[model samples]
Target: MASLNILMAQINTLVGDFEGNTDKVVACVQRAVQSHPSPVVVFPELTLSGYPPEDLLLRPSIELRVAQSLARLCAELPAEAWAIVGYPRTRDDGLYNVAGVIHGGEIVAEYSKQSLPNYQVFDEKRYFKPGSLPCVIDIEGVQVGLSVCEDIWEPGPTLATARAGAQLLINLNSSPYHRGKRGERWQLVAARATEAGIPIVYVNQVGGQDELVFDGGSFAVTAGGDIAAAAPNFEEGDFWLQYDSDHAQAPFSGLQVYPPLEEIEAVWRALVLGVRDYVNKNRFQGVVLGLSGGVDSALTLAVAVDALGPERVEAVMMPFRYTSQMSVEDAAEQSDILGVSHKVISIEPIYEAFMASLEEEFAGTEVDTTEENLQARCRGVLLMSISNKKGYLVLTTGNKSEMAVGYSTLYGDMAGGFDVLKDVPKTLVFDLCRYRNTLGPCIPQRVIDRPPSAELAPDQKDEDSLPPYEVLDQILEMYIERDMSAEAIIATGMDRQQVQKVLRLVDINEYKRRQAPIGVRITKRGFGRDRRYPITSGWRIGD
Candidate 1:
């Protein structure tokens, strides 16, 4: 019947900003101590120096700084308050993604992460060695369990802690956001609580880190499988959850509730936050992109303007001879509708310049895709020039379907500091454009209804080189994202030759995706961290 007050700080942290993260952690603990009676404040995993530090963890100096910051935080903790903080831990062998329990000005208990995720964007296996021990800490007369991010995804870690006589399970997480992930986490946490016969507290990191966007939907589930308390998603806030064993009969916590966003809305918010944080945190003045009269660029521009504001977005329309007048007019109309600065840059001169330079080499050959690619590359050069001259970052606008099939040029539209839709499928790109227009007509309707084209060659359409997006995206979702074998994809009632051809395109385009700019991930498996394929492999999928 005893009650323990636990405060969860759903914080947004900048990656590699050790000092800022430490300062925020200190402030949260201080607030928790002052607002409640000897509260235990918990933060997300690796929150001391931010999550997924990438190669920054490889730098020894960064590790030293992280350790010193932890020490400084421990020194600043109040005598009555308990703080469970996450950071990097170093041993004789290497480093670890570790959590430290600080009480009375020292680390009372430390737990290193047992599960090191090596797949996707996570390279923890390459950086830190796993710890084998389960850490159990006493929090205000209650036996509390401790596990890092990936440990709770599997059952053994939670089951182990329950067997070790822990009454309450506390997991610190830095789980990233993808479509429908909140529901999935709720299901996973509820299952864990039911199996262990104990209450569970799950805290996830918030905000964007590079291409990864962390949606902070931290919550608590009771032993009987009910959401005892839940934090707001996608923002920073501190809330206290009072857990009373007797009050398990009545699940009334009337905390501030925010309904979950729809799948499309969630994906849109994640993309906006990812672009906002990546551009702002990296210290770019603004963003510039080629506003091709296509859904990919149109959606990219809408998301960028939404994230960074219209004034911060600059769209350049680089038209080629093959580009239709309707395409040109719609590009300008969309820019005007969005209230962003627009420029008309003709790539004809640059294309002519490149052709003249290569005239001798092309003396006997008829003009082909090589000439078309030159036009795309010409636009890329001009976009980069604007980016370099104005201190703005160039945002590439290619989508997942094109990127997967190598439908894009290497240095053409592919040139940029970051790509906004590199992982978004072509179907989702259209969906997003429709979603944006529903908010208000930010994009021209003509742009949406028109056939998609690269416009590098005369009257070219995407269907000329690739399958229809409806068909192509379905095959891609099966083969690329879901990891379904080509035969399994073919069983989905698709053309056998078409399925094989799309798979081949995906395999061959690995080299192009390798050099692609980091883009926001909307699917369960994105090209960013989750999808890592060999660039030069001889593997074939289907018959």
Candidate 2:
């Protein structure tokens, strides 16, 4: 019986860092060749320029950089290994997202990606011209076919490749992580395998890039639409699979299929990876966040500690006249529990000075939200000053619900380099806080139990200003994420008045969300690239 050895080079690459990415590919191929005989090594899509190199693909120098990297891979990689790599290829016709096979230190076969995704965080149609043909090659007497990430999502490319006379198919991917994406990939790929009548291998990249995070849950499927093998999610490493020409039970061996991460668990890991990469890639020394003894900030603190250790995390509690003693103590307790640097700063003196400066300006005016916003601005100034002096990235703690309704003050709680829960809704915020506590005593129980408040005014709670979170989050999800109209949401048995109020708030707050910092995207649609709305538009609320 003859068999083929395959290695999945699951890796994380920096965008536009051609030298670094090529070095990783060469090293991966070298390590694979040392263990297996003529092993087939597969890497993720856009491995050379990194996934979604975005506007970097527009630079004229980008063409030269990709060519040089490809040349270097052929020169430095071992001749015995057969490596499949992905990069952008510039031809006279146009640019293409291509997968190339390198064997015996030469380019043997090339496959251009056929399907270019253009919706919801992807704009590939702007760059690459789609390919219409199939690519097949003979490897060690075994016929093999090739496809890129979006190709396997549909039936046409997979069927076309198999019909081109292939016994096996391999896919290169740079698929980003959203909630429940792992199961979706498994079911979709399995169907593709059944349609093609050939075993399929899927390899994806792992790590974070700005607002996006790839989970790297690579897997394989048999011709009968069964998942034969799977690598773990949220990990970057190499795994092996074998294909046997003659076998009694199954054609593939070394099966290690594991179930997907539970929904909340997947969200937590994605948040941690997103934060770590954003801070380290941008070269920030560490992170500093205001500890309000609220659920949102408490959850953000725990994630920051888990990502970069406690030594690199710092917590500052800014107390105002309305801040309760209980909030002060809870913030201190959680900081001590996590073993992070904790400090106490009083914004009273600063707020007093500001009020005194504006005393004459407010001579005839009655008290309103201006005083509340002034309190938040005082704390924002303190945190930004600390960031400037200590070289730390300030992490804001605003949740999606607050951002949706414009309940947050500008340049106050919203002023920071990054917002950890920008895409996380308020109801989800409480759920995540409880989830983190299951691992250990990270967040204080009292913090989770208390009614949420901004402490901007005396005896004020979040519900006092906005609808209950249970009602607010649902309406926001319908309008912002699913694009449902106010009437549609009301038809679902929700309060019509509440739905209209929430939708109006969301429409008016586009300007604030536009200026907000980017954060992790764990849902189907996030505030950053996933959802775009005009800050100034005459569009009204309707069907």
Clashes of each: 3, 0
Model 2: lDDT of residue 340: 98
Candidate 2 structure quality by residue, lDDT tens digits, 323-419: 9999999999999999999999999999999999999999999989999999888889999998999999999999999988898889999999999
Where model 1 places Cα greater than 4 Å from the true spot, the runs are 92-94, 249-257
Deviation from native of the Cα of residue 263 in model 2, angstroms: 0.8
**TM-score of decoy 2:** 0.98
Which lDDT values do the candidates have, in the order given? 0.85, 0.91
* Candidate 2 wrong stretches, greater than 4 Å: 247-249
**Best model number under lDDT:** 2
